[model samples]
Target: MSPGDEHDYRGKDQGGRPDDPYSTLGGTRQTRTRLPDGDAGLPHARRPVRNSRSLVTITGVVVLLIAAIAFANRGGGSDEDAAAPGAEKPGTTGSAPTAATGTKPVQGKNGTIASGFAHDEQGAQSAAANYAVALGSAEMFMKESRHQILDTVYSPAAANKLRAPQDLAYSAEFLARLGLDSDGNAPQGSTFISRTVPVGTKVLAFDDDTAKVAVWYTGLIGMSGQDSTKPVSTTWKTWTAQLSWLGGDWKVTEASEADGPAPVPGDVAASRSDAISKAVEEYGGFTYAR
Candidate 1:
């Protein structure tokens, strides 16, 4: 055996390290010869001591395997690591802003689609964010502008599906329910606001052409007026979109949303309609970048 190879031995000498200490001395000394216990020299003999060693060796191997598995399952917080076995860990990549820093929206031509994502995971997320913003904007609530926005953002197939529903969704009845006039315009002294504020978007999975992104967002709903039935309020939702890269930009093939995915409430109280209106007029949307 090599020097580094470890084997279990029984009995102890004077010094702690194994091996016979006096073997180096030239002179030979007589020592008592103990009888072999249970056929010690027989090749096929089974002994309790051998069984104990085997158990120890097996235990050591099992311990090493467990440790290795634990290390493999640990989250390194990067997108590129392979996970260890038997680890109930999340995917190698997640949707938090830290992991998505590289996925900020890029600027494309104005009057044209302006998503900055390459045809990759980041691109899919960027597309979803922008689409969510567009889908939940005041433009979608307006009859004339609604059609234009939907046509631009969704794929032809999706546009067909959304057009009928979107038309019905923004109808005179729906508009009246929000305290707006038949044309979907709010009364004087009332500010009409519909908006989606995206917190972050996570890419669940993707390929070269198609991708799925989940966007967590807060939306402002209702009309801004004291007497208005629909008072401006906030809603939390998750928007999932199937996207495809089209004409150098990402467009929605199909999309849907579910309520909540809400984060815990902060100490701050909700803002009033007046404050919300002022903020909307003051702040303008910008082209996002990764």
Candidate 2:
């Protein structure tokens, strides 16, 4: 699937399709006790003549050993001390770098979608993934919302080039094919669902002003309702975008997509349309970060 591919069921009408309606898814404790000697003749010997000095030395060594072991295991500091200012925390020498950068994900937004990402690799990946979500959302089915998203997510030149074709792709005929009205509304009593869940993102290339990122995602698109013919279904895809630092934000210059690194199907039973509708309504979406 490409960025603007019409194969996306969100914008595909279902009226004429005779094939399968919903297809193409991509402790232990120890104790010791001492016994007294029974000898009476050699009281000193039988009473176990205590070597006080040796006993004290042994006890001191044992205590020091325990303290040393504890300090080494704790990396020489408490958790609070490790977090204190000027403290040198443990290094991630052999460990994998986390997806998180511990920096604020986005500094601003264009409409509802995140924008103003930092001009770094992580920020570019974040921007691309978030842009994928916005472009694949149900909102993109409507003309007004689609325009808003294109303008917000794409660079000015790309937005201008994409507007007409994208508009055509989400036309009345296309919407009807997806069981949506001309205004991108589902029929009364039906819930239209189109959402993108980004599995992860990768930076293919990045520099100060340009970046290429790929977002692997799974998308849900279909209508859910008692009478709905198109049941909610899923598709896996990878959206790759070329982005440029423009207007103090990362914006899409172009985008393409591929099939997926889809996993095997699970054994879970499909939910009823009404249940799907209810879940979609009850659960809100998220603003994804890298």
Among the numbered candidates, top lDDT falls to 2
lDDT by residue (149-249, candidate 1, tens digit) is 77778877788788888888778887888888888788998888888888887777688788888999898888887677778878999999988888777
TM-score, one value per model: 0.63, 0.68
Q: For each candidate, what is the lDDT? A: 0.69, 0.76
Model 2: residue 277 alpha-carbon error in angstroms: 1.2
| Residue 240 alpha-carbon offset, candidate 2, angstroms | 0.2
| 219: Cα error in model 2, Å | 0.9
Q: What is the alpha-carbon lDDT for the whole of candidate 1?
A: 0.69
Return the clash pairs for model 1, or none.
Answer: 72-84, 103-290, 104-289, 104-290, 105-288, 105-289, 106-116
Report how far off residue 76 is in candidate 1 (Å). Answer: 29
Q: What is the lDDT of residue 249 in candidate 2?
A: 87
In the range 52-171, model 2's lDDT, one tens digit per residue, is: 445445545654666566555554344455353754332212323333444457887777998778677777878988999999999999888989999999999999999999888888
Clashing pairs in 2: 12-177, 12-178, 13-177, 13-178, 14-177
